[model samples]
Target: MFSTVYDVIVVGGGHAGAEAAAASANLGAKTLLITMNLQNIAQMSCNPAMGGIAKGQIVREIDALGGYSAIVTDKTAIQFKMLNKSKGPAMWSPRAQSDRMRFSETWRNMLEQTDNLDFYQEMVTGLLFEDDIIIGVKTALGIEIKSKTVIITAGTFLNGLIHIGNKTFGGGRAGESAATGITEDLVKKGFESGRMKTGTPPRVDSRSLDFSKMIEQPGDVNPEKFSYLKTTTALKEQRSCYMSYTSLDVHNLLREGFDRSPMFNGRIKSVGPRYCPSIEDKIDRFASKERHQIFVEPEGWNTIEIYVNGFSTSLPEDVQDKALRKVAGFENVKFLRYGYAIEYDYFPPTQLTKTLETKLITNLYFAGQINGTTGYEEAAAQGLIAGINAALKVQNKAPFVLKRNEAYIGVLIDDLIIKGTEEPYRMFTSRAEYRTLLRQDNADLRLTPMAYKLGLASKERMDRVVEKQEKTDLFVKFLKETSVKPEEINPILEANNSARISQSMKLFKIAARPQLNFNDIQKINSVASFITENNLDNEVIEQTEIHVKYAGYIEKEKNQADKLNRLENVPIPANFNYEKVKSLSIEARQKLTKIQPETISQASRISGVSPSDVSVLLVYMGR
Candidate 1:
């Protein structure tokens, strides 16, 4: 192990690192996964949940690409809910609250079972470089191992500084030690470094709190799984999460600790997630709001630990306790762990290419928090792409990059590399311009073929994709061709409060009505007969409905995406000189020069670049 060279060495065993190792190894690369503590592999460092809103789509996409996040989540999920179900299919996202310990254990078992992969327990101290390219990694014990590529998914470990009240300590997580040497080494090597902070809420003893005082939020009546694979099944039994609210009194109790709060007292300067603000931040930002809802979530199926969601704080321990006592259902709460904030070092993702390989260092990559992204889904997506690209580079194959229209993964990376987040970047459905075309339900149909071609997805997965596509198309055809009598369809239309049909109509037309959903229209005798005769599954039915109901919107989005794709597909020469474009704006030239965008479309997305700059580039390219 000491003398042999590996194809890819993945540092950090968080979501990103684990996925990177798995993807690299599964692609036939001799991969090695190194972590400070092997037992904590793929730990749910923050919330004990996977997939929410756009995040759920990301997990499904990972599974479609033959990664393991969805499978693990589904297997260990205690609670499952499809978020935004009231909205369109594009907004419907599947989420799962997992058994925290079992989630990590499941990930470890999966990694252990992956062939061509090795595990090592050590803290990486620095990189072994061949000039500008990283050749391997150096461990804390001074042992060096050679590798063709190194992916650092260090997460919140690099120079981690935790805060509680005015007191700060060196810890990546609550108890784990902060990593050293690597951040300093990279800075010395001329990488631009920045700081970002993220925090977790206190985990209290569930038995100590009165759930009757809070609202019971149960899982969906018919809970769904995240993975497209049939191997993982839906939850047969479920767990319920309780909801409580923080009042003006709770806010007043919290404000008393403001003097000691690291966030408010200027003890912590780095930015946290804008979308997921802490309790203090929320209170301070929205002073007039009477209350903020708090969700009390169980940590596992058999545990007293309860995560106090929506109450993330870095105030004194007593302050956290005092504030929670003021809340309705927590008059006598016992904390298992106090809430605290941690600041860590991150490299601006603009330093990375579309494939996540560093522009300055060949074969070297960064994923997860190191790339300034928050959430397990974002990190795992980056890791999966980095791992795949690293392995492809080693195997002398073309790098795989997803377009923004193709997947949410594409929107994330494109945003990171182009916009370059100063704060922690998170994914949202609104971030995707073509979200309707990138719905969570159709990820397999969009991505499995590509993954299969890359040798990442299995033949079974490909077969599933083909069957889904063929059946969905056939069902849609049947709906369009078959006609239903007015008497048969009128009752169903009346049930939905829609005007009765005067005569016979095609089932497709009836299904497309704004008021009539799949459930409403499926009651028709002909539709039910067709479903029973074809033996179509729920997935095929859902796909066919989405295709039929949102056909115009979907087609509109596709046309828009195809139009923009022309500019996206325009290639910029690798050695293209921005210095020659003197007619471009000063800020545009400077940003373009530094970013070195690969296409005219990418150039337009840069902050300083305007339409005029893009026009100049288009003119120069003789388009």
Candidate 2:
């Protein structure tokens, strides 16, 4: 039924593929999004939520880059909270509980509204390759659609295996069929693939839960959102989650199913996510601990389904029910759905470049769980970057890539492409070295301009960014240029528990003190009042605060990053033979040859490579 050649073709319609298709189409590319089932587009298969820790930063960055994750999340969010508020700014993350149905619907609607995007419901069984470069995709019905660039984000559906206790079946998600043929074809075509596993918890009927026995988990008093755009509307009367604990009784019941558990019985061989372990694994690993926490989170505003957090398992259904009833507040819980583990085919991310394109196949990119990473935010970030690069390739323009210091997305992609993952990777604040400069508060400030230049960000977004920047610059300048009298500011400073100033000081200098804040200074300084009088938005205020509070650290980080970039800029020749370097260690040569790092800096960071090997490389490159 179709004969048009698309600029970009996106396989699978999960978070990654949806974002990729939207981005490419919005960038004026004729994009085609093909999936096994169109109704499952952007489904929250594992979790009914979005954003956490460093993943939240990625969502904001995607939003800043004109990707649709943030907007879609906001439109469908049922509950919102800013996590780690008591911690440092670098650790602060925004998380939201979404309406499962609404989230998928929002994505479908947005994709349909997009100008240059076309939708197709079909399984991509194979690829049409020309001289080692991907030229198009072959559908299950034997129709071939051509494209200049193809992004594969099949997620966990590619040869997916569902494990329930000792029984296994071919399925992507609960009730959804798995996609086959592509993995076997790719393997035959010389692509290296491996198996990875991930699991989800059961859904319980809310009516059967005993709320009086559980601890109430309320949302933040003043909630924030993931998107920088004004698309977020304040929720009316937010929902509250509850906390419960799994006791020894629960553990004993789960142990009864040990023999039948797929994880223990060797029925599932793929490595699951270490960070988010299954209930049985958690019990096994943490035997010393008396109890584990479980959260009862509502699936949506309208649904009666409650997600049983911290209870992910592949144990038998009878054992699952027996154990779940023993948990606090769930004595009468009814299992609306049983939990299970999913094993799927994933191409080790080491085979990908920073652009997410496979080294084995040109113009063939992979993202999401297919690349061995977990979480919707991580997938969407990859999808967006891959889409941008794919569109750029179609336009014959230079690829747009971000530095590690520039974004969390950059850090994530860099880690996957450089180090490669042995486990399902999840983003954390500690994973980033320059996290002080990668705060979520300023993600839009760091990325919007670049997106605008690439013609991905909208004009309205660019205008808002420009205005915010101008106002923040003015505020920062005012603080730097203005001087405050010691006598006038001392009382206000004392009220904030800050030391009294001995002499007059620049407003900027006083604001930079750890004990002082914009509000504290506003009480004594005129410039602070002027800033308030302008009625700037919260995002603008947040930027000014961060800029003033972290000036020293930011400056130091920038200098360090500049020095590192010098090494990054030192490009390595692709055809250079590491085996020729006789002075290099055997292990170093092997690693260098396998990774084929794009720069000397990347080569230096590989685990087995040594500094001496880098010296050999530098000497060989005549540096």
Name the candidate that leads on TM-score: 1
Candidate 2's displacement at residue 63, Å, is 0.4
Model 1 scores a TM of: 0.99
Q: Lowest-lDDT window of 10 residues in candidate 2?
A: 519-528
Backbone atom clashes (below 3 Å) for every candidate: 0, 0
Q: How much lDDT does each candidate structure score? A: 0.94, 0.89
Per-residue alpha-carbon lDDT of candidate 2 for residues 225-274, written as tens digits (9 for 90 to 100): 77777857766667888999998888989999999999998888889999
Show where candidate 1 strays beyond 4 Å: none
- Candidate 1 lDDT by residue in tens digits, 129-228: 9899899999999999999999999999999999999899999998999999999989888999999999999999998999999999999999989999
Q: Model 2, 154: alpha-carbon shift in Å? A: 0.8
C-alpha lDDT of candidate 2 relative to the true structure? 0.89
Residue pairs clashing in model 2 are: none
In model 2, how many backbone clashes occur?
Answer: 0
